[model samples]
Target: MKRLLLLGVLLAVSSTAHAIVIRHDVDDAKYRVPATEFPALVDMPGEGHGALIAPQWVLTAAHTLPMHGDLKQVVINGAARDVERVVVHPGYRTLPQTLIDQAMASGEAMLIVVFLASGDDVALIRLKAPVTDVAPVAIYSGTDEAGQIAKILGKGATGTGATGHSPSGPNRTELRRAFNTITSAYDRWLCYVFDEPPQALPLEGVLGNGDSGGPVLIERDGQWLLAGQGAWKVVQGNVLTARPGRYGQVTCNVRVNHYRDWIERIMAEPAQTTAVG
Candidate 1:
């Protein structure tokens, strides 16, 4: 019996995948984001994605922002805050054309130039007035060791072939649950939710458009730590069921473990680059 229990735990650990399903590019929504939660999301000028991880810092995808409003302001929940800094990952290429090429080639290892969901993609921000209300998420960088269960939260869109802007609605980050196994874990890797129970998220319930730049958490014991950020999700055209539509990929939260130093270094730098090169 003891051996069986041990084996079960091992099996559980062995089967945990970490690929995130993130989406971008879409019109307005049919439904409304939660009221309590609505205050946390700030709208970027050019229309990318936004999520409040801490009272001060907003998390988001690097490539979403336009050069204009990089990281200028932050509206928490509803109240707006003036931007003080911008931080992009050092490794992220500033040019959009280059980023496009990289994405087309391997579909792995995205070097996002962090733009503060506002003026510039900010990895972290120092608020003008310290906000002690919402707790800041802890980021893990040293070990995304293969075979670890990772949890994620985001604001994915709804609606199927409802492809046009008219067919969707704003789905806020209510801390949804999606699990997968670690297929390959390197600088950047993939995870499969199929191996886990609840094979896939419902067609409309899965993380789609607004979910970009969210967190994929890794729960150890009773606590949760930030592991990956919502990146991409596969969508199918004229689809009835939820499937990884061809050319559609469930990509989110690039796992940041094994790079604790990078996070620390970025946090320590003058909010300059969004991605860590």
Candidate 2:
């Protein structure tokens, strides 16, 4: 099992803020989403979440996909399957050597590098066989997700801080979720800011480590559509003036509508895939 990197929290200031924040209780039955609706990617040893976007395809964050080349590394909801192919966005770039250098020089933790590499962070995993039992989620092709009610489901940790482990553990066996309204919708990203006062608490929740690659869903009529995938959490503290005001945390996702064509193209492409190792 590849040791999973902490998924959320990209800090802009030198001082450390609490890592990802998951508001629900670890075993809150109400927050748990059934495996049939959204299967947890047990690969990466339960590092992240993935949605069944098609009978044979799963959607996830590019950074969270297993790199060990062994298809056995990934087990979706206990059903083992080979990775037939993987399609990372053409524009996706993991931390470059240059960025690592900068991070090292600045005394930033490795996770900070992820915040620097945000944008086009989605990927599609082609499984060996079609998942006939699980229904695929529809991707939203509409204009934007701003101001829309969104639901995020994942098997990530539940708390804030260094040992902010979710009662669910790293490989959250049961998927949990929360509801929030989209605050900003850019051409390529959707975000939720967490600095609002308590009155706005009901309108939002935060993402935590291990929530990466999970789906952000929007309901259309009665069906839930995939609006985006959890990508990075941008944390900008008071870097200047030295007086740290209330910490600002932005939970961001790769907007699905902006890359609908690209997703279709990749899925249709010949299986010219590479091993994660």
Candidate 3:
């Protein structure tokens, strides 16, 4: 069995952002997409990404928000939208620094996995005004997420699976789309492996730095549904030396269906005080 190390790719202001890493044989240009293609995909604070699930609500990962203050605004439809409020799931909690340090020092992979799985990694942003130009994506409520082919969109760092993520890649801000099949589904995570060559999709890839809070979408009845939120990457062996965004690594996204009720309840509320869990 392979030991897995769960690492968060959450972007911060001073850090560099990475997009999807593609197959070495494929053209990098093939992965690029127009910004108009994914209008619901918005830019979150700290260079993270989010999807608009409702006209007034944007769904994202809680960790992407600042630790000190409320996320005051987000870029939606290429325009800045004032945030009315932000609500992180009450069940969400960050692992203590002490425990994380211990896990890293002891090389205990399961300790990190169990702690991450136990927490809700989702959050919702309420916009002061409802967006009418771009249609919002619906949350996938079905239980059949495993084995589904998902389309991941991001505009961060870029590199090939053969080389992992490169810090010197050109213009790490182009919107790109890649495909991957969900290999496993837990109550809180959807895991997928990055395969090379014959086993990989024509444009197979995985998220890199700065893609946290991005959407993993599945098509249903000609409509795209939000199935997961980009959260963490699982690397095999010693995490300290592990090169992320490479073949054989796993990308685990926050399973969206598990918190559908929580999303609905928060959206239904007339107003919510800004809270971070």
Candidate 4:
């Protein structure tokens, strides 16, 4: 389970691998992303990816943005969008770089692990201009989605690697999609296990660096609902043993269902809706 332990340790790895698609045998083009779907790709100015949830609002992982201050500039799919407001989940907490450094200095992986699994990594970006052209995906607010198939989209690494091993090269720049079964669903998170090479599913993949803030979508009765956002990738053990080349990586997605009320409230507030950044 990627839960909290794996996410904490995986964050310590090099950002070059950002996110991954573990099976080298998979075709990258077949998973080509729709031009109008999953529209936010924070390739430059910022590092992670994102998705549009409203005409003028974008949703992503909080870590994708700077700790404090407005995002002066954000490029989504080549077009620059000024961020007016940033709303991070109050409970979202990741081990800061300074804390990570302290943990490394003291060899305290447990402390970092405990902090990373708080399960609140989501954030909302109010765009300066309305993105009315692209239709926003509806958020999922129904029952538990365990065992359901979901699509994970990103512009991450296409190469495969084990848990404790580092990627052999830089991550791919093209947008990609992979399918995974929701192994488990917690109150605030959804977990999906990425299969290793010799994949059981033709489209099975994992996450690396640039994949953060990407969308995890679920389809129901022909409607694709936004269920979660890419947060972290984890292996079973801690940094010392959870090598990338090792098999079994669990990808954690911040569950959208648990925060629907908060999202709705934020969207409805006009005062917090200005494009200031």
Which portions of model 4 show Cα errors greater than 4 Å?
Answer: 1-19, 32-37, 40-44, 94-99, 106-108, 161-172, 197-199, 237-242, 272-277
Best by TM-score: 3
lDDT of 2: 0.58
TM-score, structure 1 vs. true: 0.56
Q: Residues 4-66, candidate 4, lDDT per residue (tens digit)?
A: 222323433322233446455655566666645465444434356677788787877777776
Candidates ranked by lDDT: 3, 4, 2, 1
What is the Å distance of residue 55 in model 4 from its true position?
Answer: 0.5
Runs of candidate 3 exceeding 4 Å displacement: 1-18, 103-110, 166-172, 273-277
**For model 3, how does the per-residue alpha-carbon lDDT over 212-247 read when each residue is reduced to its tens digit?**
777889889988799988877765555444456778
lDDT of 2 by residue, 92-178 (tens): 665555644554455354455345345467777888788765567888877667888887776665553223343224434445666
lDDT, candidate 3, at 106? 59
Question: Comparing candidate 1 with candidate 3, which one achieves the higher lDDT?
Answer: 3
TM-score of 3: 0.88
Question: Order the candidates by TM-score, highest first — what do you get?
Answer: 3, 4, 2, 1
Model 3: residue 258 alpha-carbon error in angstroms = 1.3
lDDT of each: 0.39, 0.58, 0.74, 0.63
lDDT of 4: 0.63
